[model samples]
Target: MKNRIFILSILASLGFLSSCSDSYLQEDYSDPTLISYDESTIRTNQDLQKFIRGLYSRLGTSSFSGDYFTYQELTGDLGFVSARNSGYFINTNAENHLVVDGGASSGIWSSLYNTISNANLILSYEGKVPDNPNGGVTSKALFAHAKVIRAYNYLALLGLFSPNYGEGDQSLGVPYSTTYNIEAKLPRETVPKVVDNVIADLTSSLADFESDNASAIFTNNNSFNANAIKLLLARTYLYKKDYQKAIQFADQVIDLGGELVGGGTNTGNTTFSTIFTILGENNPEILFQIEYNNIIPSNNNLQAYWGTSGAYKQNFMAKAFWDDFPSTDVRKSNVAWYQNNATTYPDDPKPINVKKYLNGPRDVILLRKTEAFFIKAEAQYHINPATAFTTLKNWVTTHRDQAYSKSLTGTAVLDEILRQKGFEFFLEGMRFTDMKRNNKAIVKVQKANNVPLGEIPVGDRRFIWPIPLSEIQTNPNIKQAPNY
Candidate 1:
């Protein structure tokens, strides 16, 4: 696990646009002369595969794929109540705060389009792929990879700064672009349209003819299976809030030797915190993990930001945030480790600062097995409260089916699921995203010990992030989401 990684993480954090500082901002990527055909050789799979690898390279990037946000420090290290990472920290420094737009806002905006430009070429060329005389498909590997990557790239943009799931035509999203046309000026497509396109692309990718085994889940392991593609669909469906679809895709992975891990009922050590540790993924519970070689010159995630001691002191998680965890659960250590400053914590929330993730492998776990369970629980909660209560009870219990002494129903169950989700995904760059999706509020502790309100209710617009400003200057085709 420590050794595996994609060609490289091109999507996470590289301060791509942040470095430009407006002086040469427009010049950084303006010269098309760099990637034009006449300047280099790329006409076939042999030549084109290099470009495919490049797309993976970009997805692995520190800046775009967004590794910065996951690191606790950047998110907790801020001048305000929330926090700010070097990259665009949605917690603060967003349009709401109106300051220091860490090039991330536009960097992700640009990188996705950059990857799309490459994907367009592959898709166009994919149409002419000759039928393999020996087997079922000749271009299956690259074509499938391209379409999924392209669709995913768009979704990444959408997640960063678009409105809720169904907001279409009226709500702004990335401008739909398939070609690398310098003059291409496409406004943001509606949310519904983009998601439909993403589904179509991924579905098409799954259907592609694979003459070779190019589907690799683990990077160092270097093997691509249908499982990765399937889970991506599962993830996409979850975002769409299509519970049944999420269940469908998740089922595909489980059928392919994927199973949940936990001691039967009310009795296993498996919980939120342990699931994130390195040993956690070793279990079948890991559906998908962003493999990182962690080798210096190759690929490194936001290791620098979360670096325990080499850099600045660990950006400790807020004391109050960690206090909510039950004292008996081991997951507490996984969220935030306590420090000498623990005494400074506010009294109202009364949570102990945790020491979680201080010691774990650097590879990013994108999707885990427990999430499938949580998602299933979420879908079932409203639709089938009976099943939802059962699932919720089983999940929190020491053992899988052992009835919990305490339980919830209906919205109460939904609320519990969200609370655990927050504890589970804290600082994973998901708490904010999930909160927005559920329309949860931001309960800030203006005074250290004051109990403000139950939930600080956020707006629907808060769900999507603002399109970083840098992208608008160069790509007119890109449209800023509304209310930015």
Candidate 2:
């Protein structure tokens, strides 16, 4: 008998733990039903293909549980609640990470772990693919894709739930799982250890992707491929403060022909608003994105959050972020603002809503070459500020506005890079991480509750998210984040 690896499925901490000996984990099927194999049906190419497709189906979309945009922007300085509602936005800005069973934490925790579980399931069946020279079945390709997705999901999880990774600090991070089994009782791993695990996964994934797939396959960035893995590596190393390695991996992506999304230096594509305007599979600038259409709309349509006709008009462009961009900058063109007559607070300026997620069938970018450019620029700044300045200038001039110019050195250069990053990625869900990494404060001057918004200073306890209550309740070994 094959050793059946029973799954201890924890659905977003839904607490449905199952075991191999437990009949409760097994379903009694009196008729024809789907046959699942923990180890037996690993021999067929069709089975492997089906398993891989299942994993992809579970991958989170731009909106919904795995919606990176909402989770980051709502908590950061760029977003604001124009009209208050007792929903996710309120909890997010209030720093309610301990309410693990609801809101962003619930969705993110469950969705990411679900993805991780599926990846682990595929990996459980490793070595089952035939190694035919004529390419009967490619196990390496399967493993690489699975590992890459797992690594990517874990990175996303850490970005939101864990504290900033410090070299000497031993703060806890989310549990690092390789098997979906009784090990669900495991306690949180240290941040450094989790980072190391993520790096190892990406490293193995890159080697596997390179060995199993053709270089030409990755030319299209939609799929998980070698270049995408390299981009992830770049981001991972950047977080670890390994600047040289970060630059090396980012350089690999650029060397693989990653370019900006526009048609040419200045006279190409649509107007300067092409990044937000253009959508679908043809957008050349996107390194990796989630495309949502009518056929496959399982994801949370972001339109509901920022659309003109959205249910709650709570989240809008904060005045601080809006004022940061000069009128000459092309990004300002994307902002659509209207006066709020409902409240007489804060001395009145029109609250702004971004046009990035105007409709449902839009594509959401998770990783793009533009991010790689920023990564490279930051890494360069750490090594050589002058060259970094030039790179930053060229990036803004080419894509943002022709007349934009800023000259600075030392700390100013770093500040400018992050500031520009904030504007460039406005409403794209990258601000909070940028703010944390740079040790910047979440300063807000506008009034929401009849008082000026107070600032969350750098290294505040609020920056660290609490381990979801459900996870703590279920797993006796778990500990809540400090100061929660």
Candidate 3:
């Protein structure tokens, strides 16, 4: 039997508790309904192909324990609300972890491990593929794809669970499980080290998959192709503050001939809707996206971003930076909701509810070309402002000039650059992370109830959300984030 620790690591995000038994991780399923891994029936190529599709199906769930749902749901500038409170939901801008809140907590808690376990399930069965028809040396290709997804899931997990990048390898992090065994539950590695493992997994994944799958196979850009995988690597390294690697990888994505558009960049018949729309898999700007149908299949972030009583409604943008958007910029043309009407006693409605994922159509937030550009610009500026400014100005003007009345250029350009980013991303589950990374502040000008917006206070410990309380309790191996 596999060790209990490893099993929990695999099922940790699946809402499954280990209690004391380790077999849960390695337990062979008797139910034909649940992923059937019978080595005997897997004789034909089609059978092996079926297994691969099962892997894909598992990776593509609404409440997936993976990065897409978690990042959009947790960590960002918003907060989840009391489920009983008129179904009110929003990304509360507080650092207090919400492990006990049953609804919001479960998605953040169970989805990623559900994602991670599926990857391991794929990895565990790959060696046996030769017995199956769909089993070619491509088994290695499938394995790499699964690992890339796993790496993406971990990146999201670390964004919320792990602390700073400087903590290096010694900083506490999540356990490592490749074989899906329960016994091998790895202890907490440091944040930096955890990142190292992510890099290592990604490194292997890239090496194995790139030559084979750079151009996405499906019409919907859901799977992790080479370029998309590269983009994720850049994002991961950027979080780690490994500027050179971040730049290197981001450059690779840019070289693929894609760039961020849509901020007055694209001109023509239709302008971007201020409310939720434009999430389909076909958008040119979308380099990669998690595919979902509004009704049948799940598009997790959609509910959060465009949901009525959903979390997005709760996380409407703060007016603190609203004026930052250029007046002429069509990008500001109501892409989200902010109340212009004021009631008696100075009551104005919430402002920042970005409708990027509304029900009209489409799917998840795409890894846009703009994000890659911003990452490169930020990476450059971190070490040298002049070079960074030049790169940024060029990107902004060449890419964003369509909407803006004037071009931005000056010493104080970071805000301008970030301002566009705010417009480009906003509620895409990135604002909070960007705020933290760029060393920007998260101020509350007035009290929670007070309508007044806050000042620009530096991002502090409160800025880095505490790890959810449940993890600390169950996994004594991990420590609570400081000041929790």
Question: What are the TM-scores, per candidate, against the unseen true structure?
Answer: 0.72, 0.83, 0.75
> How many Å off is the CA of 335 in candidate 1?
8.7
Q: Would you list the C-alpha lDDT of every candidate in the order shown?
A: 0.51, 0.64, 0.54
- The number of the candidate with the highest lDDT is 2
After superposition, the stretches of candidate 1 with alpha carbons farther than 4 Å from their true spots are 1-40, 62-68, 71-104, 128-138, 167-169, 209-212, 216-224, 254-283, 294-301, 333-361, 398-404, 445-457, 475-479
Per-residue lDDT of model 3, residues 1-484, tens digit only: 2233333333332222121332323444334244324335344433444444444455555344123433443344332222222333323423343434343444654567666776776567666655334333355666677778778778777765555577433465665567664334356666776688889988988887765442232445655666777888899888888889999999987887645344544443223442134432454555666545533334544455432435443334444455566544445543423332212212132343344454523456546656788888878767777777777767655655445444344436666666667656655667656766666665432123432342335534544444555555566665554455
> What lDDT tens digits, residue by residue, belong to model 1 across residues 181-236?
54576777877788888888878767752335555312332222456667777767
Q: How many residue pairs clash in each candidate?
A: 49, 3, 41
**Cα RMSD for candidates in order:** 8.6, 6.8, 7.3
Against the hidden true structure, what lDDT does model 2 obtain?
0.64
Candidate 2 lowest-lDDT run of ten:
8-17
Candidate 2: list runs displaced more than 4 Å. 1-32, 61-66, 84-88, 95-103, 131-137, 214-220, 261-272, 277-280, 333-347, 445-454
RMSD of 3: 7.3
lDDT of 2 at 302: 55
RMSD of 2: 6.8
